[model samples]
Target: MKLTKIALLLSAATLLPNLASAGTLEQVVKKGALNCGVSTGIPGFSATDSKGAWEGLDVDFCRSVAAAVFADADAVKFIPLTAKERFTALQSGEIDVLARSSTWTSSRDTSLGLNFTGVNYYDGQGFLVNKKLGVSSAKELNGATFCIQAGTTTELNLTDYFKANGMEYKAVTYDTSGQTIDGFKKGRCDAVTSDASQLYGLKLKMDDPNSVMVLPEIISKEPLGPVVRQGDDDWFNIVRWTLYASLEAEELGVTQANVDMQLKSENPSIKRLLGTTGTAGKDLGLKADWAYNIIKKVGNYSESFDKHVGKDSPLGIDRGLNKLWTQGGLMYSMPIR
Candidate 1:
């Protein structure tokens, strides 16, 4: 009897970590809202509007996750974080998931105890400068000073690019993207370097948007996406598949305006995606119409892109690498089944 009791206790102890790892989804359901980590303010990505409501590509991704879990797109608390504070917030459980425009690098993936679910935006580093500087290309700025955001891959890339070109430069660092751009506008640096998409967004904030232009050189690859804490595979899958569902919806020609109509789709792929003919929802511990809720409320990935940062939006960014795979771009979804 003593031996049996000891064995039982040992087995239960081994299962404790697993139970803790699986609690994120359950805690979210009980809390009635997901705490999402986002940037302080990067327009077209995760910034607030005139009405003080959060809306952007990253914000929309957070809403989609809320829709999948609670059937309510607005059931989320957006916590703005800086680059240095983002990882700490996620590690401390202050936020459930991070949807900020953060890059997926090997050090962050391995040493930080985090896992990047998937890439939502494929980006590269570039330079933005005032056209009056008489420099049309990055190679012309041999000894320029750059305003860059601190605690980001941007600083390292800037150093590497200049070193490789046998040139030299100085860096003026800021805590947020907003401040980085402000430093540029104030002439604190000769140029600003960041992700190309971000330079576009920052350009819009200028008093005369056309005064600045992104340079032709792209120095580094930045695959930005959502991130979840390590050891929580269940929550990871929910977030990962939430992004995939949006992509798959686009592939199947489904949109927020037509998700209901697509439910009647006879195609097996559409059927499984809409939760009408598969165990996808059951496997995720969500309702049968979970994905349907995501599409109907949040919309497909392409829809969010167009509305926030693409051609339909103010940024007017052309869909280069972000185009769907069928169109020769890199946006591809995994099998829903």
Candidate 2:
């Protein structure tokens, strides 16, 4: 059932009568499933499969977290959410963690009563228009109507970009990304604007995917990541390290196919990451092999990227800023030791 925004907000508020008392991990453990909020339908990030199973990069992140906690990747209940309702759902404890492809912004971080663990994808806002539009640059999109999802940074970014360029346009807002793309396809707007990565995913839904062209001009920075409520440090650490474990596993040459072989390695970093020589997992209030379960079940960052949005997938997005720090990218993990 589709709940109205007001109803959803009130429902979320009811879940948390006491904001000060937080125990997300305990609640999740008692329930035996991690409640993960994800996008309603973003093909490469979070969408349902032919069998009605949620599968995508963000979905994999949720699975990884579940694996870390319960040693079972499937122990997660995927709650599909719209952009407008994601934060409130997280705030009200409607979901244990939000693996939605939400950007990490200062206002959201400081004002939303939530904590972003780390960036899962580094992206930039861009426009998607029909190839017939013949518009090559975002600057040339003056006076063009745009289809944008409401309650997203994309709307504000679009407004700011146009204002800075002294251009004016009409915004056709939708509650979900799929609806925004549908609005664009149905000619409600001349263009659709979102993170460039999402534009690729959206194009997959087009009648003729090749008809859509993502303009070259990237308008704004969008560091997308997972989020959890702020009060519980333990849950925060678990979520944060779960992401870091994926990245670190990639850097340490740990893939799902080879994790078992890696367990016997002598490298201190690998040993610590696999819980063969450290207490990092226990320190985070998780089992000693928390990272091991994540790597074993969900693979590493590179694996998940390749399987969901990289060259192996339809999106074909390059690692760019999502690559490891050692590989000249921004994905640096904190020390597990």
**Candidate 1 C-alpha lDDT tens digits along 283-312:** 998888989999999999999999999988
Clashes of 2: 0
**Per-residue accuracy of model 2 over 160-260 as CA lDDT, tens digit each:** 99999999999888999888988888999999999999999999899999888899989999999999988788889899999999999999999999999
What TM-score goes with each of the models?
0.94, 0.94
Indicate the residue-level lDDT of 319 in model 2.
Answer: 85
**Which parts of model 1 have CA positions greater than 4 angstroms off?**
1-21
Would you give me the overall lDDT of model 2? 0.92
**Alpha-carbon RMSD, candidate 2:** 6.4
Model 2 quality (TM-score): 0.94
What TM value does model 1 have?
Answer: 0.94
Measured on C-alpha atoms, candidate 1 has an lDDT of: 0.94
